[model samples]
Target: MAELLEQRSSISLQLIDALLEVFGEFNQLNIWSKVTKDDFTVKRFDLGNDSNLCCCQLTETAKSKLNFSSPKDCEGVVVKFLTFGDNGITDNGLSLADIVAVNTVLSINQISPKLLFANSKCYVHEYIKSRIYTFENDDNPEVVKCLARILAKFHSLDAPISNNAYKTSQKSYEDFFNRRKHIYGWGNTEATGQKYLKALENHPEIKEQYYDEFAKIDYHSEIVYVQNLKERLDSPIVFAHSDFNRGNRLVVKDSKDQLEKIYLIDFDATSMNNRGVDFGDYFSNYRHREDFANEGFPSDEDMALFLNEYREKCAQIFGTEFLDKKENSLEHMIDEAKIYTLGSYIGGTFFGLMWYQEAHDTGKGQYFLNVAKNQSRGYNRLKKRFIEDGTIPRILQMPK
Candidate 1:
């Protein structure tokens, strides 16, 4: 037992060494105050088992050893350990993508977490003592408008990233669709499909009634059609936060300024995409992880409130000259946003499915399963409305 424990400890030390190797040595970070990795210890934060990265909060051991006067003096840090695949290559440059995104967002004076140090393997950030806003709990009218303005400013950024990796909605959807081909009933060959089936095996009704029916729709053609409509409608492409879900929207507890309270985090999915997708995706988040049968999409008044704030903010950023154009008009963008809402529904469906698959894989309890199902059902409801009401086709045929 002693020998086995020693081996485990040696492996952990080796892993930590490898993590720090990306930056050469701990002292090189410049934030260390002349200390090294051995000077302090970190406690792993329990974010979830499903994350691709691990987070560790710097503990009081460091503060005491460093003899900091107060918590605010040092402020501490959260170190994020990024994972590499078995082949010893990073996950498609996730760490670098986030670094590039952070640089761009900070350049725009956007409210993202301050990244202290980052490389391809790992990064450190000033720990935020903040709360997350969920639609079910913090869905205040004013909060919604604030989020809209934040999003508007976010989408207005035009900055260069690591490799100019910008892609259109059609292009992004094609890649995503190809990856989750099991959703289109090609699960026999797709690993994700096999796991999806295994996860939902106990709930055959969801498969027969919802999943099967959803698979019947040709999402590829549908996405292509939407892209064409988007072009005719003149929907402007912008740097999108892409995943504007509740968790990424942090409400800093210390900030009394309402304008400064909210911060956007997690820029892994940040990219150039249709502005409508960002708007539509934010609107669709109202029903995320709620009681699917009871909760509904944001009311028309609420949506109008959000959209009006967004429009006014965009006008401020782009000037009335640009917004006055046919494609940039409020009415046209609203119509375009409606078209993209369908795409958001598709995104929500897969997001829920992926979560559910992960939940099953990790042997998570029923509560987690229900949470995953709520997401799928809620977005499915939105997709069903568009289909039954012929909303997408109507939007497409409308005057551009």
Candidate 2:
């Protein structure tokens, strides 16, 4: 652990130096406090607020050979420093294609802190540009509606083609998740399974499920089949937020305490896939277990509200009837849940079971560990019963 902390300290220092270089001496970024997100590096700092002004989000992976794009002004305001990943990221970094996809989505969504000059002459880091407000709860109704609306509109758009750039960009982003799973699972499924199984010595229920699923996967074959299913599916390719779970979406509230404009952050996992992929991630917390980022997943009422809202938005935006089809096909929902659950089980296992101890041992504390833990637990519980047993848990039931 000492070595781990030392490594983090070194990286932290490097980030400070880069920020110092960017912000300059006068309006130097001061690290007032640090907050933890489930899957990213975040630090909250006072950007020269004697009276505690709005906080600036300086979130970019700066632990590599950081390079900058030529600076540009937004609405006549010039940002002091705007660095791009350039060629800095060795194992994982943003690709030019990813940048274009993000910029494209920002335009399509008609949302902001909209891409402030996409592919700008090497600008690496993206900022919120305005004060970001917090949600009162994870299941804040406005956020739910906003999420559904954005997703419906997004799904209505055409997906990116499998060009070289598209492949390269998506590969880089997906690899970022894989590396963590590899390292945290101690580089392999057996080793990582051991780490999680050890942690679950007390919980036999999940232990049984873990062993059962792990036993079924050929990894290479099963994953390939799933990928093939995605490729061959007749479903339309749509834009996806990828990681649409908590901490990614932020908002600003009105004077009446209602949500005004909502924005989704962290486009690292953004890609074009079947709408089911987005829906799966959207309802990640719907299964059993505890510590969901939102308030214990969406209830039947909430799901109805969301889908009703999604239906309305899709009708308006795409002129297509999505959720309320003839026979109101539950088969599609079932198929989506299968597709989503399998992926979620695999990915959530990597985080909840394998990555929890790694994050905790390395000083990430409870939130990251809990995200890793609870997500796995919830998925496992849902997978064994909902996916395998065909039992519709409360959250999974559709409105009649």
Candidate 3:
């Protein structure tokens, strides 16, 4: 253990040096001597706390890397070095334009998650603002709207499929799903379900109804249902940012107290999937907490308007009929959206439950457990809605 830690430390130092050397040769920034060399504590906005800082990169380098030509350059550049336990850097140093492009794609796709800036070897992203507690008062609504607009504009850009190597992969979707399953692991669903079940068992009276609902479910049956549903859906597949959520979106507020811009970050989970997956993400993230019981997730009446705007934007870039026709196509899209929502809820909840127990036992953060609980609730509401609206039967009856 000691030797491994030392080796990691040495590698980190080497990486920092390499970054400095590369930036220096470009006449971008001067590398200062190492001021700190400890475990880098990952923070929300900045790089890890223990990251080595050098003079800011040259104005031109920063401008070129970020793809912005600032009239004035002030302050120094700080290069942060980070080491993941298992996941290596997926994206590294990126310019502002790269960040913008990423976010633009996400907004157009309605994919949300923390925005990540990356180069060929390293990844950079904005620090998280704060731990989110209540979505009600948070700037979520304006943020969603702004994201919708940005996504519309982004999808308006010519498709960059030629730039990505994975676009032509044969088993892209399967590979993508398997990778997610591995990263999430059995710890997300099975372990989590056991933990929550134990908790509910301990507090039977307080959580009786919740317990009863879960108790009636059969895990194997659920799994089979999902597998069968996947085989039945005939939605056309497109390149999608698979892990879309609010956490992935970076929201910037303007002076008018409205959300001005949204940046989509994180492409590690990017995949080719149904467009409905993106819609599911938008609905899942934007739904009202109270509406969870009724399966009436919240969306601004403007959501349709936003979709229409996105459609127009996509048409401009992808062609006049990029999406299906506006009228009949919208209705079909809504149905597909519902199906995708259910699929995501079920799949995500299962993963959550599997991981919950291990996370709790290992004293890992409570994040996994919270995700499990929230998604479980979402699944229940979605199922109920499907049953009540007769969608479940219709889905089951559909030809595979």
Best model number under TM-score: 1
Query: Which candidate, 1 or 3, has the higher TM-score?
Result: 1
Rank by TM-score (best first): 1, 3, 2
Q: Candidate 1 regions off by >4 Å?
A: 1-33, 36-41, 45-61, 67-74, 82-98, 107-110, 136-138, 162-164, 168-172, 179-232, 255-260, 287-294, 351-380, 383-391, 398-400
Q: Rate the local accuracy (lDDT) of all candidates.
A: 0.57, 0.46, 0.47
lDDT of 3 by residue, 1-400 (tens): 0001223323455565555443433323312222222312211122112243222223334345444433332223323333333333123222333335554455345444332333433433223223222245233544545555555553334434322323423233345445545653322345444334665454445355455555454544565565565456565555555555555555555667554445565554454545666667666655445322224554334346545555655666667766656422555555556666766666666555556444545554244545555666777777777678776677678788
What would the TM-scores of all predictions be?
0.73, 0.57, 0.59
* TM-score for predicted model 2 compared with the true structure: 0.57
Which candidate has the highest lDDT of all?
1
lDDT for predicted candidate 3 compared with the true structure: 0.47
Q: Model 1 compared with the native: what TM-score? A: 0.73
Error of 2 at 156 (Å): 2.9
Residue 176 Cα positional deviation in candidate 2, in Å, after optimal superposition: 9.3
